[model samples]
Target chain A: MSRPALAVSALRPRTAPGWRTGLLDSLDAVGAVVLSPVELVGMAVVLLGRMAEFMLLAPFARDRFAFQRLIFARDLGDLLFGPALRVLAICVVLGIAVALVIEQFATGLLSQTGTANLVIVTSLQQIPPFVASGVLAARGALPLAVRLAEMVDRGQIDSMAIMGVDLVMLHAVPRALAVSLASVVHAVLAMVVFGVTTVLSLAGLGLVSTGTFLTALKLLPVYEKISLIGLQLLTASILVVAVALVEGIQGHGEERVDLARVSMVCILKAATVVLLVNLSFALSRMPDLPVLVWR
Target chain B: MRPAAPVDEAAANGLSVEVRGLVVRRGRRRVLDGVSLQLAAGAFLRITGPAGCGKSTLLQTLAGVLDADQGSIRLGGRPAATALAAGQVAAVFQRDSLLPELTVLENLLLPLIAGQHLSRRLAMLRAQVLLAQFGLVDIMHAWPARLSDALRRRALLARVMAVQPQLLLLDDILAGLDSAGRALIGRLLSPPDGRVASIIATSSRVDDFAHEAELLLTLPEGRISPSEPGQEGSGCDTRP
Candidate 1:
């Protein structure tokens, strides 16, 4: 005798949506959208706090400090030197491009002092950090993220945990510290290279003389350079690394597709963070608009 | 040859594991459903199950890698996380767990140096001894990716063994091995001196383990079934 067939939908339990359910669902979606950034910020703060603790406490604990130092040195070397040539090539090209643009726009419209001011504002102040961050994000943060995500996916992180390794001290602290220090160094290096190339390109183009550029640079105070480096340290290095590390640690699954998806997300988030941070900094520097006095 | 001595004093002794009503869920599926098991110090328990039967999940939960939705796990009269933090627990996962960036010797040295806070010289000496015992001395300097499958598995086991953990969790350590490879690992699992205190290993087939396993429990779909008559032992209460 043939058995009677049963409908697949009958086997599954179903719940009908009411007005309240739809309202609640909408609220949940809205809440997620609103709270996600807050949650991300909280994670970044906690990660940074733990890293600071490790850095502060590690030196006194001499026995564990050696391994931490080894990891730190390895990561620092990789970050600083791994993409040095690429950074140099990019900076050279950036310098030439900036110089060409400035010369084209500022030729007759501005004086030598104005051209120097423009170059100082754009080349020395603004562009270097962005370039350094972009390079480091692509070369340093992205690779670190991939490695960390792969480690998480492959159970290597769990293995480390099983062996009693402090995940923060071993992975996050060293990488974050390295990325921060390397970002500052790269930004400074880019600035110097960019400044030199811009001056030379303009000199070649006869837009401005080397002496005028030197005078302009001399007029800029040392604190400004320090502030520029500090700004890069804050935004490109610390923030970007924090986002990458958090995304990496939250990696799921061992599939190549999962890894690629995580990496793409990391890069996009990091780029967005960098842009937002720079925008905030720029806004903070802007002069207040004039307000009408009311009687 | 025997592996190295325990770097931490607490790790020298065995950990008695007591798991009660462990429940773990992955997405919509209950990977581990109210599983309960007990293992005494210096004893061996082998869990056998079919593919996707929550063997790895159980091992991971016990090792404190994955938290249970509902359950209590105590090791050596302390919590599982505490025991793990004290270097009293070591796990070799089903996948290759060695750090790809480090070499075989570095892999061995990491837990000893980082976890146990052993001196570099002492850690190096212990790592060398473990490498020698596993017959991995020649490939100690080789990267994990460069090693053959059997050798990689051996290295992973050696690295975990380097800590001389009180409780060892082996998740399908015998999965991809030939008979000889299995025999080698089996011998390591049941050393003559019994330096390792307690072990919980999972395998797809019951025969994968040697006679060293005192109790064999079959986990089908996350619940422990009655053991086969001869597979039962006093060490484990298979009363789920």
Candidate 2:
């Protein structure tokens, strides 16, 4: 080995996870926090641009405006069965788990104090929506990513391009909108599913009365619900488009194994984006947050 | 901006293609290097090369798919990109380009419907006529994915013809065809009185297209050079 290489190799054997690496990693974490707003907004712009492309030029573009709505309705129907139902199951399961904790062990103390109110509100407002986002990222977005990737693999995307079909407008836009709208719909459905399950479980053991539950729930205003739904919708749309670009579009140019890896990475990244954004939105509304939400 | 003209009015104006020192790089390797050629309107230039010899790259560059790393390609006194944007070029790659969801007739109607306005009745009538002429009338309603490889290639060729593009590019799309199929394509490409410009890349031996092609160009070692049509003895082993 050369003299410099020999010296660096000798140094590496002695050093314990260098101080420079840790310091750089810490700096990166700080940068992420400071730059998150810019990052999120940039992601939003990209999502909007892709959706706009789909709206303007795909095969759907040739139709009349009324016909476009009919197509959008079809897209909505597809999402309800695909991503929304998958996410709904996740939300319901989460609600049951949280409700069980409250009912079985902390019945008296939780019912008497503010913790009961906090748990109830968090269950409906934050937890279900967050978990729903994660579920859609994995379940709802998976098939679209796989289909687009396969198209890319088989030269179908290039074929459309050759025919002057705007692929982004054709493929990306429809999926993005479907996922976003489905996310919002799923959030509402999840909250309903979660609320009903939690209330029934709490009532079954005589832990809480039905009247008390409904009154506590009315403490949160309409704006809180609107804000949470809006945030979830935005996050879902952004992650859906991001996954499509990563796993769907780029994956088309890759082999099956590589595409699978890309797809797994896409799902992980989408879930991460959803969790981080949901946490940020929750923190922003924490002080003025809604009261007992499972009524 | 000027008002739009009739689609066929502009399509009848032929386009010539010229490439000078064109170089295309995939990752780090240079697929095409300093390749230069000229083709007049109403001419057929057959490109013969071994596999992985950048035959597809040259055709893709000419069709404005992959951008050139160095040098330039001009189509009818304008840049290749400009000609492509003006709807002067059409390419049939080795892979199947049909949309699986659509019937063959619906997919064929895509290009024809893009720039021109047609009522559904008129569109169907015209599509019937074109498919009939291409000997594909029976399979008009069939799904593209269900067709055989040779038949799929013919459907793609039929789409290219429907567009009536000035510059046509075929990149080994004829590989799976039988002799009759090959002759049908050859005749379609070079009809008795047609003035369309075309550049085809094939691994078929020199003798296969000797009677049909007017100019023969061989891409050996990254650069394209001219060779005599059906020349028997000049022997360059080009089986890739």
Candidate 3:
């Protein structure tokens, strides 16, 4: 039959320049960030954590994940690099900062594990959660944001709102947010596994005497761990929700044309949340500040 | 009061569309500003426009793919948004928006799947009939990536038509097709015996089916300028 002829015609339009340009721009942006030492280290930590969570631990129940054949690495690199790089930066900085926080709280936690070890643990703790947040933001928040931005770009979302599709449910905070929270939940579980392993490793190495180790473990109130998990979950949810709400309602861009604009907004949202959390923790420790009740 | 007779005339209104105060905005630009239009059952109308003048926007709004800002659009006196979403309206877009991976038959049944109203088996049966009618029976199992440009256009048209919409919106559906191909597609879209009300958007030089068309409006930079309906030409408006 003339099926082959029809298929060739279907591809006749030549995949749009926008898709190619988007991929190229993403690659260029990533190349710029990865050239710096601090940025590269940060990138490594964040990516490693994400890889471990996404590929190793198989977070989000993505055990069967395989990139579609049509979804080439070049395309993925182009699509994900710019966005993923920013995710890496936030993850790395947050990881280092958290490691510093934990080092002060519990002695010798990273004495054996050098900077690399600290990077590993901190990246482990921070990367998955951060990556989880990004995924949620991208999937749960961005689609609607993308749709709204596209609408704003095309004037369709506004019309949709005018038509009453329940802008929040039909557009903003449903699928993307739900998917993000689901991802964060997965990261939280991984954190628990990591925490147990770290605690056990310290005990096994006689780093802390068995008596002290057992006592520390015993004194580790379930309430505190639960609260910590709750905080991470809350933070991830807020970031995803905030990203969806802010970006979805704002960015005005043509759906088919402004992919770069969309990716930028995604990165901005991820970075803003990362900065907010880091700043809050940093401010909490200042010697001159009035103590907040929560702290 | 007159013997409670089943009035055959009452059932043949075909598809009626009433749109009031439809406004569409993209960013700061208002694409459609308080625009209103109507279509009687089985009426054929052509909407022509210069590029970027909201012709496609208007068609998409009618198809429920794009929501209109501040408007009331009804099909058969019910909200067209709901009805179209429920498979009462079929749409062919400017782009080949068909899923690239699915076969011809599979693509046609996407709407039924979207509505969650038709089973896979029944949808396939309907798809086969549409494909056969559109002369795409041989390519029923072929992927969209393998089809010719003409076949791709016909396949998309068939997919939308398979939904059995009371209202059909054709947005720049003939952009790439040759004259002969366009004629074939036009006949398939508004078969003479077909009862569906249709609105087609084009930028063609030829007035091919003026006899079948009730209204022909050209839009230059977003303003509708009406045209007179001409005599019958090579194309059939598809009346019985």
Candidate 4:
């Protein structure tokens, strides 16, 4: 009736035993992690490079910044907050598991393989996809979900059908593609971070130095892995987003449809896409790197 | 008192709508159970019923918003489903469905733009004329939220008219209007010479509409009782 007073009132107290408050707290924690020195530096460097690229091209610089400003305002939250929040959650959980495993196996596993560092790096590789998916889910999925909710409430989606707008193209496909791009960025960022951090840390420790890690990074397997991950993330994002958008639009036909239902569909879609990507990546591991890349 | 005819006279052509066993379900409740009716061209049918009696649902189903469980509805000799699929119907609801943030002109522009016929210039000219005709020229730029309930209703009606619909489905457009305002809108809706076929769901039976209407289909519950000849002075049955 009166906009159902979103959990803002109950969120006043820190101790409020509500999901809304909990979500806020989790978001705040994510903000802290993303703003940490290393991430901030990475983000700033990326932003500066983009600006420099704009500046160097005298003809296109102004137009580029104008476009960037429009896109940045539109995508800031999904780009910055979505993935950062996702990374925070993943880092916390995975960080705990990795710590536990290291404590348990300690000297034995590390000493035996002489590749324990590789294992750690490989495990951390998941961060990018996680961030990308979060961005996709947030940027793309949130708006679609919100639109569906509004459609259900106001009956506009029904009106759309009455007017003969193609339900899928008019709303769904663009929504999916828009969200998927965010996921792609997230995954690429994660890969870059992984590559750079491994090189820097290995050099700092003097265990393998910068050139050694850089050489390892150049190995065919690493490129193959990153590329394959990109392909997989793209594929998965498109699929999940398509499904979620379709479902959200279809929900309007019902006598009554709720946001909870749309959200469940979103979660299910994200999970299915992630699993498919993981499976694809595992399968791609056996293929020859060059062949896979070209094909 | 017949008005002078327009040169085009296209707006005066009427369209017929037919429903065959139209059944609608809102959860367990079957709002319109095996409902069947036929509205001829150049005619007005006033649907009257008690509150919560599926009067609005029936109109909505015709408007293509609600899906019928079992049956078919046709508009202008084609399936209502096909007609809507082909983009050929417009409606005005009991509740003010105007976009509150937008001005009266913007609200009217939505249907025209959506229908993809009139250009911006043509739409502006038509909107201005409609506003002036409806006496809404004073507040054409005012947001719907700022207008009074009656004014908002009038603005929405004006917008509905702007689309030049063949089948105009109105849901209680005259519900909250004062006598003078209601008479004016009813007159505009039913210009003696103009022939826009319509189905208006209303609680009150206005005296002015009595002469113009061809049929009166009364509904006590969800079912249409019987179509009787239009009678004068049998208006404003205000009993709740």
Candidate 5:
């Protein structure tokens, strides 16, 4: 007797041409790499828009905004105080290390004014925001992602949705705002610590007098200080938190392995976003990089 | 104290459910296939099947948590999603549904304040009353991690009940409870004043819900098996 057609087909080997398969794989990789940022940006826009709506409507819709206040307070307190000591330690160490390196390398190579200027600029305008982003990502964003992933895995998010709770309003907005506010606070703290440590180290090393350091600080324009704060705020509030919220909400899986993977991907993506944002800002400020700006 | 009336008292008074040719596929497997059922307002249904027989899937579908691949589900003459958005549907899953971060009292207050837009003072009052009703008054400030399995289940039910859902979908709520725990929760499930208009509960064993379920039917292989001629509360048609 002849074998059944189904069994015959099941026994048949299936293979795609090697060249075609390779081409398709390459295309898929390219598509993922190109489309991921676009998708992330779209989601971040929608999330931020919803948060703005809730905030703007709070006065007229106090009842609706009441529950979110509790969430905001809780998250804000956690984000601000949870990593305060770590951030402080990092800032103090970073400031002292940078100061010592500048004193050693630039003592005779550059004038005292130039060395002090470098110290002020690097401490206040650069480095601290990047370090703050790293700290917040590790301490704040990753944990937020893990917590949200757990909620997704456990079906608590679905349960909340079924109960008529807007997940964005209830969870995302508060967290994004908290992280943004906390990032600003941490960045400010870092800048202050770096300024203090650098000044103290330079004075102790005799590379620059306290008078010279104060003069360098006075030479730094008010606009520069404002711009630095603005840069930190924009990076943390928009980019870092957005990455965390998107990855946390969308990257959950049904297994513990999936949770770990999601956490890893969230941190990596957050770090990439922070770096790209700071790099863009740095490029825009460079006088030689006229191509980055349109007059 | 009596439970507070639902936000939409008119809609909550009665929520009739009609599900037709419902299909839910999980990957390659059809979890719910061509299942159909009709439930009148104020009725109780017990869906019994072996483990992995789509009981929870049906509940999730009915709660609007899962999308139906094919077919229709209507609650109170509206689509399931609409009814759910109106705060007319509540569900308790086999898994722990309580937010671990919130206290028992805060958990109860969540749906009220966030979902129903009730004032904090009113939500607090309603939450306290529900806690007292569920015998959870003593542990009102306790977190879900601190509660026993039975208490967690009770607290979950209490939180869902906070919104006074018109249709209650319960999946294996009595699974981990002892006999006394089961009995106490069973009494709570069928409140006297009829705050909940309808309930669809699922269990693996038929006898687990024998006392409270008004209609009992079996689901085998993603389809509802017809009730035997002499089965109790078999008046409702659940054939697929």
Candidate 6:
């Protein structure tokens, strides 16, 4: 099939000195996402392999020393402190704003007999994540895109390869994991911010009591709520990593190439992909997301 | 100068490289077609080819980074990929390929850290000695991005030596260096008292390697034929 051909093409032997064909070869696997199920599974396996490679390169692998873990923690801290802070703050702000507007306007017709409809209409578990993940991707992914693009623009990838180091393991793996962790962190931070904002804003306005507003959130479909949270994180990390890699690798040149220009494009493309994934997934999975989160 | 400490006896025994009917096809074009050659441990093989003759491919194949479409490559009777996976095979590309974010010392110590899992103290000690041997002590802490091309080149070669791979591959990295750089290439890439076997591919035309390279081969039209220093039959494809 075309997929096998693509995989073979990725393995094309001749590398003229100037061609950064390595990046193109990686793109081949990415292209296979559109292929048939068997090929798609194959592509998934490849992605998993790279993830494993990245994990092994991670400084915190089980075998590493305290020193290694300390260094790795510093890197994760840098990412968290830099771009991730914006993601968390933005998610919280969006959550609080949406909560304020929804609560203020929706005088739910909660006649004592309307409890079931209240459960369906007033579930805080579903829409907040969509908003939070979207905001997080928008506020996050760009800086990471720039950093990754610059790594490629420089010869860091080639250096890793020549060292017999797995490039994905060294670069991609930690990033995917860190950003995924950051996704959850954003979700939790949003929950806290929304909770606090709800108490302070409603108390200040003397509208609804904060205890009753929180009581409605208690009966969440626990499994679906957790799964949705995971799915959002997974999608966000994958989209950011994929777009960054594509943009970074496409620029297969050392001289006469503007790294800043390439990185700017990478940031734009990554943000676009992140938003598209958030929107498409939210839309396509809409039927199930609320049923699970609200039930 | 010798290795900082006594080299591992096992590490000192050089690796032999053997390729049989190696074929590497790129986009319906046979970049390397049915290539066959062999080199005994401690031997030197120099490949000179014009652009696009699969010089880098062949070196990469020996280094076990690139796959061979239809052939076999063995280092010391072990498969090339297996040897490479075990860190017994090493390569230096034409590009600096140093970790730009890392200091030269950290880059050189990486092989030990990644492969041998050497402790911090030992890895640092080994890296320093290797750097000193290569006359790179002064810039050991400099970022690779800040170093000059020639200086970075020396550091790259020294980094490979730090690995002490059985088979060390050079992909035309020795071109355009001043004499000091060339001498460093000779000292590090030559027999090294049988500590490593080296294959150098150069697109440049120069005499720096003439005296030291025991057997030279030229790649024209995807075929490997002997160059000067006559046939060191053991290092050539002497098939009928």
**lDDT of every predicted structure (CA atoms):** 0.70, 0.62, 0.51, 0.56, 0.70, 0.57
Question: How would you encode candidate 2's per-residue C-alpha lDDT over A152-238 as one tens digit per residue?
Answer: 665555544554544444445566777777777777788788877777777776777666666657666534468766765666667
> What stretches of model 4 exceed 4 Å from their correct place?
A1-117, A120-125, A194-211, A225-227, A250-254, A286-295, B1-13, B18-30, B33-46, B64-74, B77-82, B92-163, B171-218, B226-240
Put down candidate 5 lDDT per residue, A77-176, tens digits, no spaces: 9988988888889888987887788777777865533544444554476666777777777776787777776766666666676776655346777777
Error of 3 at B208 (Å): 6.6
List RMSD in Å for every model shown.
Answer: 9.4, 10.4, 13.7, 13.9, 9.1, 8.5
Residues A1-295 of candidate 4 have per-residue lDDT tens digits of 0111111001112253579777887897798557543542443344334344544652444332332333334454445555655654554455445545544565464433334445445544555565566546645655666565555454544443343322223344334444555666666665555555544544444334455444434443555476767766656655555545544554423345577777776676556656666666655564543342332
CAPRI-wise, candidate 2 is incorrect
lDDT of 4 by residue, B138-169 (tens): 99888777889778878877877776666677
lDDT of each residue in B167-213, candidate 6, tens digit only: 77777787777777776667666644544554444544545566566
Model 3 chain A worst lDDT window (10 residues): A1-10
Order of all candidates by TM-score, from best down to worst?
A: 5, 1, 2, 6, 4, 3
Model 2 C-alpha lDDT per residue in residues B61-142, reported as the tens digit of each score: 7766566778888887798767676666777766646766568897777655533334545656777777987789889999
Model 5, span B165-219: residue lDDT tens: 8888888889978999888888898776654658888888777767776676676
**Candidate 4 docking class:** incorrect
Per-model DockQ? 0.29, 0.12, 0.07, 0.07, 0.25, 0.18
In the predicted model 5, the residue pairs found to clash are none
Each candidate's iRMS in angstroms? Answer: 17.4, 19.1, 15.6, 14.0, 17.1, 9.0
Instruction: Give per-residue CA lDDT, model 6, range A179-225, as digits (tens).
Output: 66666666666556655665556445554555555554554443455
Model 4: DockQ vs. true structure: 0.07
Scored by lDDT, model 2 comes in at 0.62
**Over 4 Å off, model 6:** A1-9, A12-33, A36-71, A88-124, A127-164, A194-295, B1-13, B18-22, B33-40, B69-74, B77-86, B119-122, B175-180, B190-195, B205-212, B218-240
lDDT of 5 at A70: 75
Clash count list over all predictions: 0, 3, 20, 0, 0, 2
Clashing pairs in 6: A53-A169, A54-A169
Write down the DockQ of candidate 2.
0.12
Q: What is the lDDT of residue B94 in candidate 2?
A: 60
Minimum summed lDDT over a 10-residue window in model 1 chain A is located at A3-12
